[model samples]
Target: MGQIIIFLVLLGLGYFFGRMAESRHYKRIHQREQAYRKLLVMPEKIPPLEFSQHESTLVSGNVVISVDYFKTVAAGLRSIFGGRVAAYESLLDRARREAILRMQEEAKAKGADAIYNLKFETARIGQNAGQSLGSVEVLAYGTALIPTPDMRAERIARNNLVQGK
Candidate 1:
């Protein structure tokens, strides 16, 4: 019957649109994950006289601080439906990597070969608290070691001789 064909077509269209919307939301999350991988860092504090004079001969590393947010919003919307959404895994993974990379760059800029004492934390903003929009923020820092000012000068001279140009 023509009615049956029309009904089937309508059903097919609905399924297609639903799939598209779901995929679009997921794609946006993926893009966020990618952008999250690009670590953004600020800078180190200018130490006073003592911090400047201390020679960093021991082993240590920079610190990375991060928060994971995924459950609060999902909990809010899940009550309206019969199921829960598993979307936070990728988000958390991406956030962790972002924090590490940021700290790594900071340590490298400070001439530190390694890092230690890394840590993490988490908190939830309730849906009613106006902070459950599903965003994670990470802050990382570390004590970096630079060569002695004299050694730096000598190293530069050695490099200048190698090229001889």
Candidate 2:
């Protein structure tokens, strides 16, 4: 029967897709973790020159990344039958955390002692031509400031010396 043949085709397609998605998500997660690790590797090395006291303040930046087209197609096929797709959720969650962590590290590298001004923006990137199973991403950033009186004094002295006011 034609119906039977169509059903077989769909089923075969689904199986193949699911397998491919399994591997793709595995690799994506691996890459995401590696990215997080790279962001976190900022060693606490002082600059070659004598460190100047800076009353650092928090600053931040953010971005969102959508799921790939292949991923969307695979998820659509899987959704025709069952419960939630845990892999998709896990991937997005990990990405969100990585984005935030990257922003935090960026602030730290810029000599911020503590970060304060935080913001997050999220939206789906470009859409795919076929499947509509995309995701929204959220990014955040903040400034870091030193919390020491010595730094505050130095900053004040510098400001006064600059303006002669």
Candidate 3:
């Protein structure tokens, strides 16, 4: 009886804290998503014609996120029932979004107007992968398109024309 009580208590605590943390992370992710909306991300092997005058460089963002206690417990129970483990869905969503955001940050820092050929790689990380749930590592990579000097000059001239300068 005592052990059961302890388990319940821990489960409740895990649920409460996990929910709070998830909410906060989601809020932050939404805000950053909005901020980076203008930075184009595409998964095409060939860039559009407009990007032909640009220089390309590889960029990547990696993030490792651990499952909360509540999620792990819920997933274990879900596995026994042979049903979808919804608990892990949000965890993956957050990880993927965060990885993309990080990649966009790098591209922005390098003066990239857009990222093309976007790809993702994911791996499970833990000491005992078979027996226990572990952290998920998400990697987002792409080619950043930066305007070359000639392209920049042409853009400047075009802007001047539009402004009647």
* lDDT tens readout by residue for model 1, 92-142: 555555555656555556655344435544343333457443455544444
Pick the winner on TM-score between candidates 1 and 2.
2
Residue range 31-61, candidate 3, lDDT tens digits: 9999999999999999999888899999999
Candidate order by decreasing lDDT: 3, 2, 1
lDDT of each residue in 77-129, candidate 2, tens digit only: 77887778754675466556656666766765664544444555666655565
> Regarding lDDT, does 1 or 3 come out ahead?
3
Clashes of 1: 3
Best by TM-score: 3
Descending-TM-score candidate ranking: 3, 2, 1
Per-candidate total of colliding backbone pairs: 3, 21, 0
Among all windows of 10 consecutive residues in model 1, the one with the lowest summed lDDT is: 58-67
- Tell me the spans in candidate 1 whose CA falls farther than 4 Å from its real position: 1-86, 108-114, 125-133
- Model 2: lDDT equals 0.57
